[model samples]
Target: MTTAPASGFQTRRIVESAAACSGAVVAGLSLMVPLDPRMMGNTSALEVSLTVLNAPRSAAAGAMLAVVAAVYAMIFGARVAWCASFVAASVLLICAIAISGPVSSGSLAIVNFIECVTAGILVGALAAATLRRPGVGTAYTVGILCGIVIGDQLQMPEAGAAMSRWRWLYAAAPPLWLSVLAVVLLGVGLYWHRDQAPIVSESTVISNVPLVPILAGALMLTVVTTTSEWTARYDFGAAGLVCEILVLAGAALVAALLLPGQDGTLILLATATASAGSAVVAVPHPRWSWSLTLAALALGFLAGRLRPAPLVAAGLTTALAVYAVLTCGIAHTYLLLPVIGCTATAFVLGYAFGAAVPHTVSGMVLGIVILVAPCMIVALRGHENGTVGYSPNWYRDPNGTEGLLPPIVAVAVTLGCTLGILLLRQLRPVTAGHIRRLPGRALGGKFA
Candidate 1:
């Protein structure tokens, strides 16, 4: 008997499924806009700091909640998860309208904070439960996160007094927009995600990576991204923001071509660059040496081809950390240069990791950890330092960022890169070119 030809209907269904996932991502992004503290007129700096930390905690919390919701949905039905997600979206809309009306007190900000945490959990759970493909699910989660980065670049004149004519609409527009998107998302969920189940991929079975390395790597990223944003604001003209993105994309292309090897080894080197540069920048009055920093990062990305990449990278990271400690009173003009160098390393490493993981939810988890850990680590550091009330305690930093942010970034980078390389080895193809799914090892085949 001849094998049946593939059905056009099934092909159409798959296409529809992918479209639904992308649209659902837009809805999730809209849901997150109200949670940003900049919309609230208090403690913007603290909120930014807290934001760094909140992302990872929020992800882990939401992951647990998603598991619970998924189990419950399995027991009951997908409709329940759909309802929970819708209600959360509605509540976010209501809160946005209510908060935009007038200033009640400082405590009202607390309401917004709670809304963010609660909504984050629900959205994450919904994303986890409804999506099947790793690529689609990851797209949804990452879109939800792009809100802050995208918002900062937009030119939305605050709903000010001049727009008093459309004042009500201006205040209500965002929530209204989000509410409509939520309805659309719910409809999509019911139609497409009703009985979908996740498929485990071969890469997931062999690659049991840990979060320990992410924590360390994240610190390096946090310092690099945050400082770069702050400093870039000073250099990039009105068009500077656009330039920043374009430049990074260009750097990504260069790094990808310049470096080729295991994904984990590349990530390890990226973190090492962070470790090295942060040490120099954290000091006072050093010669501005972005060339040195970029050279270090370039070496890192290229180092992955070597058999002893991990050892060399770890030794480099340690050496940089100690060197920075020794050169405690150094400062420089092109401070943003090293950050740019390290940031490029991290970004390239991230996309490479993305390509390496098999299309699975485990891939989604790893992506989020790499992206969010740096912010969370730095946020914790900010709390530990208690508002930088006096002269900076470290980095001889008049701005106080060095004292609170650098150490956290350094520690996170050093550990994350090392551990990531260790995990990468086990995930290597079993033979010269074929892939094998390690049985009973769905969670990074080794640890699980």
Candidate 2:
């Protein structure tokens, strides 16, 4: 019932504008600076160039840094935001300095540590600032960072010294740092704001849907399918099945906590459909590619109609489709039968459980289940065949092939399946309760 104070709102607006500006500047600089060419030549030269590039990336990083700063500012005022910014900057600087030696000259080399640290600090600051600025969200910060990382990846060469160095850094340092920084920033902000009342909270009387279960189920389906392919020889089916059951149970438990009249079964159903679509892709069947494409389209359509729950499911399914496409080329013929079967099984299990659980809890439970299942399978299977196989000019010179087409096919099938699903769901009428109920809300609810 309580609203944000006038001062809080005004400060949030100011910080939001600053955060947007910072993000724009950072995005521009990230594209302009060439990380690869600058880090060329001798190690000394590389170090110098990296330090020089640091200034621009640092400025860009300011958007995220401001987000964190704003979070502190909102809870403890401007002084706290400033202090947090200073601390964040110092921490990043120290991390960069410590890791610089490896990138320059060392037996156990450190790759993009300098660039990542510098960028990370700026991002952290922006994130803090954005969080502090009440109405301002973290969208700009996330968008800029994703763009920089993707751009860096796309621009990097696949072969030679530069590429080798880039890959080493990409695999080891920057990602780890970013992950750590994200966790730290989120944790700190949450801790500081724990006592503060939320600006918005959904009521049980509105409709009791389990957001967690739906997400968990969808994630579980993805992981299980991915793991089954990654560890084809493993027998983790029982464990995966158990996880699905747990997700459904959790959803049911959450539903029990809501108001008596609440109903989120439709949401659970929608999530299940999307999760199933994603699982089909993971299975890697040639036909599954088409299935995945269809599923993605269907989920997307349902998401638009269902609001929050379906949207989440659609996003997850879309991710699955993307992963499938990237891993598998356009040809679905290369996908293996076993991979497809496993993926399908996982999807079916997730869908069944997701549909059975309470709407209130389904999303979170499903997400957790999806996330954990494949990881467990992978761990149980061990990593004997984890090596990356290279194929020289696969399209241009098929004679110089290295790996089998099964994996590739698996990827393709998933993509196709996702697209197909989406298309079908989108074209279907609103009266078709199957797609409409998928995200838990009635057709004429908020979506109408």
Candidate 3:
């Protein structure tokens, strides 16, 4: 028996994906500067805000821009597409700065949105490209989500308290400081990743992968994530932390134990357990958020070593959607359901998407759109209906969220049904052994 050359191992693309994933995480985390104020229904005391640059809108813009960049990656591959995104983002930033300043103006806000959107687009493209690797999709997922956990952790401190505590960082143009850091991180990621050379040469096309399940998984993730954000908004202490730690650790252990084998089955089990655990523990925890993120990173590292499959992505996504629907429907009756269910859903969704859709730019965008649409609706609707997030202002004025259940049910129901139907036609993987025979299926079956 002859062994492959040492160059084979050296050619691993996981590091590149992981690095890009880190940049995406920072982008998500650092974006807090511009997006937070927009969501809070207040103007940024820091800069001239845009007319339409609220939190939800900004996020939507980022998602859309990223989708576009991903499309480009689909056509031109990562190298050309990312370079284009960099050029485009730079131009947008210059334009944003030219119009932004002390005086708040709609045009300035628009410019700012454009700039951030550009960053988001590149991040999305990079994420999708990274997913194209054999075992790196999960790592990228870990980095991006972990970034969110870190940012949220930092954000937990009250503005005044945070400002006072991190005085030097927050004092003179905190947003600027954060933005620069984001840009630097992104640049470093792009440079470090440069290109997924080996993966590209070895694998290029996604084959026999059902689009519906991919989309379903993406949409399922969106619902879970949105709900998670809201659920995590509340608090849970020591017990929650311990639980989160265990779940995250368990997720990684499970992934390491089973991957690059039964691609879909691994994700199915992984997503179910992860979400179930997170929901049980709850989110928005003060100390445990970072710990949870650390756990996710571990999951990513382990999962990245394995391949992902569509059947499992779809099943897991369907199950999560069902779970979310069930949880949201009964949240009124069972108080703990929302916190446990949504948080669990979010964690699982994050892992599932990272594992399932990392390499498919189009699939990633579809999932992102599914994820962002509800937030956009709620954010925009909040302006009109006086609802916060989706279900209303439980934090401030509980009465405002009274009619919220209907909308929540509506969104959840709509997503669940669509994905459930999509699942019917998707080919199911019977065993993990298929992963060994059809490893290229993880690449979406496109062989060049």
Q: After superposition, which runs of candidate 3 have C-alpha atoms over 4 Å from their true positions?
A: 1-18, 29-61, 88-103, 134-137, 147-284, 293-346, 376-422, 426-448
RMSD of each: 13.2, 14.3, 11.0
State model 3's lDDT. 0.41
Tens digits of per-residue lDDT, candidate 1, 1-448, equal 3334357545544544443343333333332333342343443545444543333344333333332333333223345555566555566666655655554445343554545444544544455444443344444433433331122112223334354554442243243554555555655555655564433333552243333323322333344344343332243333543443333323322322222234234434444443343333332212333234324333433343223334554555555555444433332344553344333333333233323332333223323323322222223223334321111111123233344234434544555555555545555422475321112222222111
The total number of steric clashes, by the backbone 3 Å criterion, in model 1 comes to 21
Give the lowest summed-lDDT range of ten residues in model 3: 390-399
Best by TM-score: 3
User: Model 1 Cα displacement at 65 (Å)?
Assistant: 2.5
Per-candidate local distance difference test: 0.38, 0.33, 0.41
Please provide, for model 3 over 1-448, each residue's C-alpha lDDT reduced to its tens digit, 9 standing for 90 to 100: 3356555454445445544554455455433334333233344533322333244446555655555555445545556544554454354445434543343434445654665576566555665556556445545555555544343223222334433454544322123444444445445445654755423333433433234333333333344334433423433444543343334333322322222222333333333333332222122243334454466545643453354443454455445545544553344455454344434444555545544432234444444333332232233223333332422221212123223332333333333333432332244334443322212233323321
Candidate 3: Cα lDDT at 318: 48
Sort all candidates by lDDT, best to worst.
3, 1, 2
Report the CA-based lDDT of candidate 2 relative to the real structure: 0.33
TM-score of 3: 0.54
